[model samples]
Target: MTTLQVEGLTKVFGRGAGRTVAVQPMDLEIDTSTALGIVGESGSGKSTLARLLVGFETPTAGAIHLDGRPISRMLSMPRERREFRRAVQFVAQDTFSAFDPRRTLRDAVATPLRVLREVTGPAADAEIRDVLGLLQLDPALLDRYPSQVSGGQRQRFALARSLVVRPQILLCDEVVSALDVSVQGAVLNMIRDYCETYRVGLGFISHGLPATTFIADTLLVMRHGAVVETGPTEQVVDRPEHPYTRTLLDAYRRGPRRVVAVDPVA
Candidate 1:
């Protein structure tokens, strides 16, 4: 089985008095068919961790391994880099901004296939259609530009774009935070189904505990760039050990149904 492992992963910025530790040394492992959620409030470094895993940012002090092979080494070589990209895909929160406003959804989805030289002509068209279909998006929308669709549709299209590449791991960073509550629930369901059907390992980064609990089998809670708790979702949510974890759970229980902020008092 494919496994993505991180050991002593860390990221720091600036120097001396100005230095800020964005992500402290942390370790994690994700295997195929499993979903791991990283949840925390703003400035907790959840997004930074996702960036490091997807190669958007290089690690300051650690190693990322895929099935025992170093990802850093894989990223250094042109051929291996392409392979790595195919193996791991990222879905960002700003779905509209992620796509070119001028391009049709089909064009946006087809870009990766063209860059990777993976498919062509009718085959590529078929692949794009198939993946978009999986997301329950209408085929007619394929001809529309990003600006022509609703935010929810645009986000689903973003997911379609990633799925078209047939990635083994899906790294999502606050993917549903921008949508309406109803739309968020729909999108979350679609993501869960897609991951299960494809047996893709999911690294879901979100500030929303409710959404994370809905989608992830395991939870990794963060606070100020450090892991405050890690365990099965139920245990962490229902029987939290860390004070921070309990605070988060309490907030979710007491706050508005859709929000996921931490409570001032636990």
Candidate 2:
């Protein structure tokens, strides 16, 4: 029953003539077991929104609440801030930059456990193995560095690093965009499985609507910095109200057999 809410969130960069509104005023909420999909072409504000939710980016004007408790107060308090960070996790698309080439994946995954959760020694080792097993990854892969694994493996490892934290809400930004069609499908299915199994709220961000269709319970479509459409996944995909949404559905219909391999990064 953990709920994360954001209201009137806005982000503006630069000033005057060079100013750019990365995100417009917006509101969104997600709780445990709710899968919310956010889709838009490249340059859309979905990524910015994700950053804002996770506190990686500060909002120009807005408020965030966790279970009706303002994030402002939670963040201001040291112990609450630490706890709040653990409740939300972000998995990024770029795996190449996430880990150190010299260290084993095991060490990388174990850092957060030791630092944030204060889990170490045998407890941390068991936790790492358990999370990896859930991802269907072998414990053997932990010995390998980031360079040694395939893109799909590296991506899953990135996710495992976050899942090791056992977050209540998980946000992924294009975690499957770089994989092959087959690999992408497996990763997407894995995403669905892990989130559901853990009862975690999911904020899935992607450029293609088709990618979100099978996984999202609620879909929010964005154009530029504005939300063009938002509703149950079936309604938005089937009876698209906006012209831009229709265009997305049309593109999906006309796409090739590997339909999920759509990255309209416009």
Candidate 3:
């Protein structure tokens, strides 16, 4: 099985008395067939962790390993960097901002193929169609601009773009937080199914406990850039060992639940 490992991963900003630790030294391992959920309140370093995984930000300390091989050194070479990009993909929370407002869906989703040189011409077209279909996005919508679609559709398109790269691991940073409750469920299900089918390791970061429970097999709860609890989702959710985790669960239970109508995609 393919595995991604993080060892002593840490990130900090500023220096001296003004310094702030965004992500404390953390260790995690994710198998290709498994999903890991990270839940935390705002400024808890959830997004910072995701950025570190995807190489968006330089880590003050730590290393990322793919299948037991260190990837940080390989990332320095041109060819290896392209391969790294293909192996790891990211989906951001701001779907609208992820896409270029001026580009059509086809252009946005196909950019990875072109950049990665994975496929071209008719092959790329076919792959794009297949990925969009898997995401339950209408192929007709491919001709439309990002601004023309609903927020849910935009998020689905963002996922489709990520899928085109055929990544071994996918990092989703609050991808469903902006959607309606019903839309959120659909997107979550879609992500679960896609990861299972492709055996893609998933790192899902979210503030919503219920949503994390619905999607992740393992849970990592964080507070102030540190892990408060880590265990199987069921154990962590049902019998939280940490007060912070229990408080999170309690907050979710007290929140109002809203039901929204969702469309069935063939």
The lDDT ranking, best first, is: 3, 1, 2
Error of 1 at 185 (Å): 0.9
lDDT tens digits, residue span 216-243, model 3: 9999999999998999988987899999
Which sections of candidate 2 miss by over 4 Å? 256-266
For every candidate in turn, the CA RMSD to the true structure comes to 5.1, 3.9, 2.0
Give the per-residue lDDT of model 1 (tens digit) for 1-266.
78889999999988999998999999999888779999999999999999899888899999999889899999999998898898889999987679998889889989998776579789999988898777778889989899998888888889988888888899999998988777787788878888998799999999998888888999999999999899999888789999999989998887554433221110
Give lDDT for model 3. Answer: 0.88
Q: For candidate 3, list the clashing residue pairs, or say none.
A: none
> Candidate 1: global Cα-lDDT?
0.87
Whose TM-score is higher: candidate 2's or candidate 3's?
Answer: 3
- Off-target runs (Cα >4 Å) in candidate 3 are 256-262
The digit string of per-residue lDDT tens for model 2 on 1-266 reads: 99999899889989999999988888889999799999988999888888888888888998888888887787789888878888988898889987889999999899877877989999999999998876668889889898998888899889999988889999999988888776787777777888898799999999876668867899999888888899999888779999999988888788742333222110
Q: How much does candidate 3 score in TM-score?
A: 0.94
lDDT of all the models against the reference?
0.87, 0.85, 0.88
Candidate 3 RMSD to the correct structure = 2.0
Q: What is residue 49's positional error in candidate 3, in angstroms?
A: 0.3
| Candidate closer to the true structure by lDDT (higher is better), 1 or 2 | 1
